[model samples]
Target chain A: MSITSFIPPQRTLMGPGPSDIYPQVLQALSRPTIGHLDPLFIKMMDELKQLLQYAFQTKNTFTIAVSAPGSAGMEACFVNLVEAGDKVLVCRNGVFGDRMRENVERCGGIAIMVDNAWGEPVSPALVEQALQTDPDIKIVAFVHAETSTGALSDAKTLAEIARKYDCLTIVDAVTSLGGVPLLVDEWQLDAVYSGSQKCLSCVPGLSPLTFSEQAIAKIQQRKTPVQSWFLDQSLVLGYWSGEGKRSYHHTAPVNSLYALHEALVLLHNEGLEQAWQRHHRAHLELKTGLEALGIQFVVEEAYRLPQLNAVYIPEGIDDAAVRSTLLERYNLEIGAGLGTLAGKAWRIGLMGYAARNENVALCLKALESTLK
Target chain B: MSITSFIPPQRTLMGPGPSDIYPQVLQALSRPTIGHLDPLFIKMMDELKQLLQYAFQTKNTFTIAVSAPGSAGMEACFVNLVEAGDKVLVCRNGVFGDRMRENVERCGGIAIMVDNAWGEPVSPALVEQALQTDPDIKIVAFVHAETSTGALSDAKTLAEIARKYDCLTIVDAVTSLGGVPLLVDEWQLDAVYSGSQKCLSCVPGLSPLTFSEQAIAKIQQRKTPVQSWFLDQSLVLGYWSGEGKRSYHHTAPVNSLYALHEALVLLHNEGLEQAWQRHHRAHLELKTGLEALGIQFVVEEAYRLPQLNAVYIPEGIDDAAVRSTLLERYNLEIGAGLGTLAGKAWRIGLMGYAARNENVALCLKALESTLK
Candidate 1:
């Protein structure tokens, strides 16, 4: 039980996330632990904000990680911006969108639902119709990459539609950022939240969030105070804001930030376009192999996310048994279907460092053997 | 921009939490990413809960980590347990205790402040006096080890007093859990929250929380629903209850839990009594060395926490400059004074893996060099 120095086995991560962490990111994580408010670490925080902005593809000055998980980032957005009695349209196509509705209701906002089938993308037309009916809706939220079903919605078109209706848009890019194309500025998205473990290949703790100036303006104009003080952006900005006079918020997961920096730097080096291409390439390779093994995708070809592929479980195949076999026999890991798709589908993620040729081959072979 | 996979320079980590991570903990963190709800991962979760119970020295069945940092753990305890109009007594002696007041007020509870000076323990006599004055108080809250000021309160006495007054106790043991002698069962504590980083020596993110049966029953019988859905134990328990049928909560930070599990295993290997003795031994050694160097501890010796020592800055010396020089020159990290003690003291942490003879020596030598 006295732990010796670590020697990590090289893994081919094709699960939801934490995808295979880059060796460099791991090294960054093991660096010296410094105070969250230390000047050197604060300097790193500034660089992190800049890197997050680049990854988010936004010029918004408020881009930073909430010192918790993607769920907290989602909570921070809703608690600060959604005041009581505000009508918010939550487009539920998967688990994360439903979480958005929960956030809205918890914040005392009236949740106006726009339901889409679980495996399908969020229909821009449905969102538009909801907005037309609820003209007073303040926020329209949807998932960009629905991890549950590997569906990619039209976030750009949805944001444009929200703009047309004069409602702000909140996009959950938890599974999409860095792996796919996300044009926050071009799409005119107001608020977006992402997880580090997904496409970013960083340790999971800090969640990256970005807000447009208009979103900040809305937060400032809120009448009722945000319910959670730790998540209130008005105060959190004091710590994450790079200016010399940073106030104390909760301690930023300091070492976690280092992992994020290294991940973002890795993304930049690969280039956004190349990163997107890499995911698509890996996805196609995985798809071809799985298809050859008689697997059918849950989401249709056009709407499928390259990073996460939800596939139907073959008839008579026990989902739990297959997954257990994969883990015990091959040390392979993949996601189970969530919500409506539970027991009927499997989610295979090709993300960040996990999206490699070898990972695709290993997953397919292990899954094939388990199915047999 | 690619990471070089450089090895870490072994240093004596004698700072705040995120102290030195054990090598095994890092290896666990680098383990293959598995689905959050994978059966094997669920098995790991169950083991983690048991390990947390051992670390907490409790038989509470409701022990689990809030999938966030210590701040979110504080928020979870307050938001779930304290409803609107609930009168809660909060003892404020340091930064974290003040944070509890913020959480109480944010959750719409009336905060009855039991004030204590910074660097001082919460006066039990004062708390008893307040309880007598406000007999309707529902919750009594205080920090066990004040990380910011290094003041350790008498949690056993405080919990007993709260129980006598028929009020639930919410204890913050963020800095005390593994490093100090804690008796959750013996103390009959109700709701306790702790950090993974502090004495646990895990990376930051997970916050271990335990609720006594009474606390759980109160939460179950609450008239008003917990406002924050993410922190609601009712919903979260379904995911972490370790039952055969586990529900999916928001994706748990997978690898961080692995690191925590390893840290707990390491602690279990070195029995809790031995761990406590190690912290005490290191504290005694550190105190002797600091006194030799003409330094003074802020708290009285009788009330001092073994893991965290707050030393007053010498008059006319730039406290920030010395810390900056130490960090920049020797790559040594230490905490600065917070709140009322800002610019007046430095918090030196002898936490978990950082609690060793060599770290104490390094800290003292580094201080001497910085002063010179």
Candidate 2:
């Protein structure tokens, strides 16, 4: 049973996540591993928090990365913010929103799901109406950018309604943080979570998270202990925060944090607005090419996410065969539709370093040839 | 706020965990990122499972790495196996055992603790006595090697007692795997969790876990849903297993897994018994040097872990000053004591790649100069 070292093929990632990592970020990941409690590593953590604050456009001091993936980040927010018997209005437009509902229910919170069509943006009016109907709802949760459908909800508008109803908002910014406009402070978002694998273009293990003052208050006043010891942000805060002698929680993924730090540094250098513009421009190029190929997008132009383009599979086209051809023949990857859109739609990503004209061109040519 | 790319100083890590990583493992981490759902990535995952099984010395088909760190892996084992009303006999000898108790309570299980001295190994006789007294106890949980105190508990004897009482066992092999003799199948450990950072010398972030069929059966027959959506082993099993189409759970930490795979391959190549012997030899060399310097070990000679050596700080020597000097002057890092031993002892690790004659000599020379 001798297994040799694995050497993976280099493929252009146009999938929903784990987009092309910058060379510097990859180099950072291979850098020397240090102790989690090391002073230098802690200094890096403080900088990472500040960079995450900049990316989310939030002054929230609670911004930090979860040691796990985006899903754990989502769980951290829910378990900390939503106590038992709390009513959370979960706006479900795509897979992530449904996941939010699952998180709420698992935390013993009642999930009042406000449903929307698969590729449609979460309607602010519907959220308002739901909140008005259920004044008992203490939190309103929604995905700012649905990676499952390429639909971008109006987070600012939705957050405004949540605030108007006197409810704290939990936002899934997993696919939107760097690719689109997501102002946590401006939107008054109480709890927000994003993925390192998405627009950050870092590797896929860590989850960047932030909590507003109100969110912190809710957690502080909670009667029940957070069910998950690992995801409990209260205990985690002691480790990530304080001046000197931070408490030890779990071991921080040292090298992964380095990769995230470099990725965030790159983001800081490019400027958030410029990065968003680049994603949009890449989307436009891919859109034009797909239009020439007679492929139709699942989402409307007004609400589609620039980084993630979910398009309907061409009629009579075999979904698996085309994706396999693209992977095997062209060494390219495009995401298959999830949940309700499965086998019918394909998600093409242009995120972070992958949000470039070269990637768009390669993906277009690969799809065109594969479809033929 | 202007922040540049973080360039970490190269330091020799001789801490309790996140010990010196193999250069090849670090190189593996820098490899290009791939989509979590890529077929090639899935193939690598399959090989990774085999490598983990080899490290664990088990044929339990349920072995896989948890996406989070070792603490999360501990939570996964408890949440899946112990239900709300179940009675779990938690043996507390060091920091990790107390953490195990916390996990048990958080999972809604009643924790009946069997206490031992901080620097002492868990007594198998006491474990048998506790099981005899509590007929309702469903599981017995203990740490094989306590990183905090450098004590190696008798896992085989404890497992024998647990099975005699018709109970399953949850063993913390975080600091034991690869550094010492841990026979999972032979001891019949029901649920075992380990960290990549410890004896494996991989980067921190991933936890390699395995469950015997008995443990799996208990999880499968559980009355309540596992509290954590992210840490739920049942849901994660779908993603890690099956022949053709693997389900997507969370986006796996791709690069970390690559490093773990390479680390495990190296371990397999070295042979587990040979690795264990190497750690012991390194420990003896370190012990001889420390004794010459008039430093004393915290744990007794018979039960001390070869990987983690907790030593008393020499009289009048400032703990932080010595550690800081080691870091600043020699570019070396050793662990400060945790929990009960804090401020009194220093934990010097000789695990995996760090268990070498050169590292021992360098650490000894650094400590001697720092003390002076």
Candidate 3:
């Protein structure tokens, strides 16, 4: 029943997420708690929305953070936009893409799946073929940055394909948002969801979501009400949308939002382009170091995400054992490949604060020693 | 868009739900982020479950924190247990109880509501009467602490009533868990949900939940699958149960869970009896101080919640002005009444670390000075 004060070891977090948190973001987490509806807090909320729009490179008014993780962001987007019996085209190239199919099915939407190789990016050509087969598809869903494999799909190309088929787009930018380029408006992405912890360098909890005006129109025109009342955007907007007369959807996680606001501020401070370049630089350094150690990346260079590098595990090395030793001895963290790639690869993240020269150097040196 | 670092003012929070956070809890929030499924993190998760069970006074195998807020916990409980067309008797005393009804309706369950006054405890007799009238009621739902109006319902009596009527119980102890004594096993409560911010003094995000053997059995025996794939207890338990091969759920908020673990540890360290006594002592002291300032409590003394005190807006006094002045001049926070009691009463909370002689004295002094 007793516990020790958490004295966290200084781990070089090169995992898919909760990639190393910036010290400023940590300080933001410790700010004094405030009422969610406090005027000052509400002001911060408005600013947060604008900053998110900047990060997403969109001007949509519906941009806001869901009071849950990125998975709930997936749920919220589907539950609010897709009503019963609607046909949704879900393209799966990784675990998160499959999760999109699950969301579609759970929303009572008929899912038309377009499959792609596990570590490869979603094939726009395959998706176009699926659209041709299922012209009735109302929505097209895919993961832009597939966390399970360090693959970056051509989100713009996929959105264009969906547009040609007259289907709305639901893009998962959970691992891509601040670390890479995202053009929500330019790509005409209908609904996009991202997580705070991944590239935002915030504490995990809030999921930033932005819906194009077209998606809002779809939600408003739904024949049946949203099945999950808690996630029903219509009602939730009353709480998160306007000023002065905000309705209570639920008690907003007040302090968590503060941390998010601070994270977004940090993002703005660094500039999105700068953050992206930082990730790319870190990944290049890590890749060079890792290749020197005879490690091969699972994802092809053209489609690979700079933030998350999927390296093939060396033969005769136990994936779990190596990870455990690094955690126990070196306090270094790297992600294991998910699903089909499990036991064959390690996902070394270069995201946010984790996407730095020092962390990359530390991970390579520690990994080298651990491998030896 | 530019944003200043969100510098939270050092305020003495006496709000309805986010009762002031402890400094230790704030420090915990700033701890380094870790992977949700890391071995050390999973070890911490196991310890957290034990601490939560102690706070909830339950030995249920299904006790763990949901990755989202208390509302998600509420949704998880209803979505997982009450399948489509299940007859659920929802007892409404305040905002949260109404939320349960919304959850039931959303999940396609028929909600038979037993409504009560906002500032009064849920009448056990009324719930019993409703259950008797509706024999098909599979679950009876109620809130232990009506945060909107500082009312304390007889959760034990209601659970017993539900048992007599052959219905399972789902209790919302969101604001009662660590502040008031919640005997989950003694009452034979089927499912219970709570928040981290209220009495736990942790940064808000994680929702602690416990389900008895009976609830788990019901989940297993349900004819239809749970509506929400995200909240399905079967899948979630595979992750939080810490037994066998752990299936991955959504990425858990790693640092927030650390904060919760620390809060629970703090609670158990103080011991439940002493925690309850501390709340009672602070409430009594606050009451005496407020009485000296000529304020009247909204709820009947016998049914008043020690953690949340709803006081009437005195004649000839401007409630908004008083609160504003308190915030501007004294850096203090107190909640405005919600729902029917909105603008009519002021909610003063003294919960967890906030339920101390120092906080009580400070809040009382601030109120007195502001009134003058």
Candidate 4:
């Protein structure tokens, strides 16, 4: 088989995640890969933790990137916090929330799911009720921003309710971390995880994760070892922790970390609040344009995530046909609906570097022309 | 914390893994980010699989890269095959073998370990003896090439022994793939995993893995769900499988895959056997130079890995000081010994792109000056 070098076509990514990456981040990714245990690389890791802490708006020292994707970060949180027979109240609003339940089950933990409609936010009241009904529920888990449906839950309120019930909270901030306000410390989120490809606008693969002292304490007190050795936070702590000389765990994805560092630097320079507002402003523009074209959004305005806009496919309009046309003709990528909304909706993302006036206009124009 | 952009200093990497990456591979990594589901990206993914199959010298349809590092790939093999209460025969020749035992125990499988001395190859006779003693052993696991001690085990003979006992095999080819003759299909190996960073000379996140049909059948017949949801190969198979349409398991590390594709392409272009010979030739050059400098090799020549050279530090020489001097003055990175050999040995790697005459000369010259 004669296989040559693969040259990927450049496209405007308006998908549910993996939004347009900053040019600098891409450049950083191409930099020379150094030894993961090199002193210089270790120094960069420390800086990366600080940058992630700033982005998550937390003082949690356990903040570091998992070497895999967002799902692994989700798995890391559950496998480390939930032990065998431990009852966890998982709020299932969208795909990620359901994934949390799977993580819990795989870790041998009992999941008490609080179901919500696909296009709606996780109800804080329902979560509170579940925890109250099952006082044995040791941890509460929910997605802060559902990438599947563009729904944003009230993470602070949900976390507060979990705290009131004396339960630790695990938050999936994959789509919310940089595009919206995610005050991990203020919300008292014990465990939170996100993807680098989402609002962070870095390449996919690395998962930015943070854990509170309570979460670390729970891990330290585990009766059984974490099922997945790659995800076990107790062991990973030795490598990421700055207390002593860094120990060899696995080879850190050196270049990906470089991209994440550059992306975080851009976010810090832009200012977190400013970046969130930029996403919101772009969403408003896109919403107005879509409304003018008679397209309707899936989630209500109040609970909608600015970065991820899920809109119902108009009646009699073929979903695949429209997305295909946009991809082929315009070199634009708008996500197909996932899970429950597979054929009924389309997810248009305005995340990080993709959250710009030009991208919004291009997407609106492309959709209008394609529909016509 | 005002952390600006992290500019990593370029160093000549002579480490056990994360050896010098090819420049083209680095360029491929920085390409504009694309969606994981982008049709173009999927095409690249298919090509990547073919390239990996060529490198491993296997036509196993189950070949794919694990989203994490080599350690995670090891976890995937054990978690999918060895169920709770299943008996596994693990051979401990170096650090990775003991890690395999950890993986087995974490999966609730009983590991009957056959101990071999560090810096020595795993004895196929001992493995046959262990499997013979434990008729119930479902699998035999060993590292084909030990990065810790630079010992190259006889994978072909060991796999033959395992098959003779009606057992599957798990081989860690992290430091062997693309650097030596790893005939996966010819040897009838069941399951094997490798690191992209090692001999492949790609960046360090992804793990190239291949599983024989027998291994897949065993996974399909598992009594319980794979303990780690992230590493559950059965689920990942849907994403990597070239069936109707690729399902989303997790966002593939898009850019890292690009780098791997390019690295594998370079390997294919050079011919796998040619690449192996290059590594061997570089090792000879390095060996002559190190011997001239009064250094001693840790592993005997018969079973030593050409890609990884573990050598003893001279008496009265401070281990850290020499390495530090090499780093600071020469901008070169050499690996300190790991596990049992730590502080007593230095590992100089000649893998993939780093396995060249120029690199050997630089490493030898750097070592000579630092020792002086």
Task: Indicate the residue-level lDDT of A308 in model 3.
Answer: 93
What fraction of the true Cα-Cα contacts (under 8 Å, chains A to B) does candidate 1 also have? Answer: 0.31
* Per-residue accuracy of model 2 over A1-372 as CA lDDT, tens digit each: 888888888888999999999999999999988888889999999999999999999999899999999999999999999888999999999999999988998888999999999999999889999999989998999999999999999988988898899999999999998999888898789999999999999999999999999999989999988888999998999999947679999899999999999999999999999999999999999999999999999999999999999999999999999999999998899999999999999999999999999999999998888888
Looking at model 3, give its docking quality level: medium
Worst 10 residues of 3 chain B by lDDT: B1-10
Looking at candidate 2, what is the lDDT of residue A99? 91
Flag regions of model 4 displaced more than 4 Å.
none
Q: What is the TM-score of chain B alone in each candidate?
A: 0.97, 0.99, 0.98, 0.99
How many clashes does each candidate structure show, in the order listed?
0, 0, 0, 0
As a whole number from 0 to 100, the lDDT of residue B360 in candidate 2 is 98
lDDT of each: 0.86, 0.93, 0.88, 0.93
Looking at model 3, the pairs that clash are none
Chain A only, candidate 1, TM-score: 0.97
Relative to the real complex, the DockQ score for model 2 comes to: 0.85
What CA root-mean-square deviation does each model show from the true structure? 2.5, 0.8, 1.5, 0.8
Model 1, B1-372: lDDT tens digits are 233222334444566666777777876776655666666677788888888899999999999998888888888899888999999999999888889999998888999999999889999999999999989898999999999889999999998899889999999999999999889999998889999888988877779999999899989888877888778889999999866688866778777788888899899998899999999999999999889878899999989999999999887889888987877777777887888888998889999988888788888899988887
Please compute DockQ, using alpha carbons, for every candidate against the native two-chain complex: 0.40, 0.85, 0.70, 0.87
Winning candidate number (DockQ): 4
In candidate 4, what are the lDDT values of residues B1-372, reduced to their tens digit? 688877888888998989999999999888877888988888888898899889888899999999999999999999999999999999998899999999999999999999999999999889988888889998999999999999999999999899889999999999999999999999999999999998889999999999999999999898999988899998998998877788988999998999999999999999998999999999999999999999999999999899999999999999999988988998888999999999999999999999999999999988888788
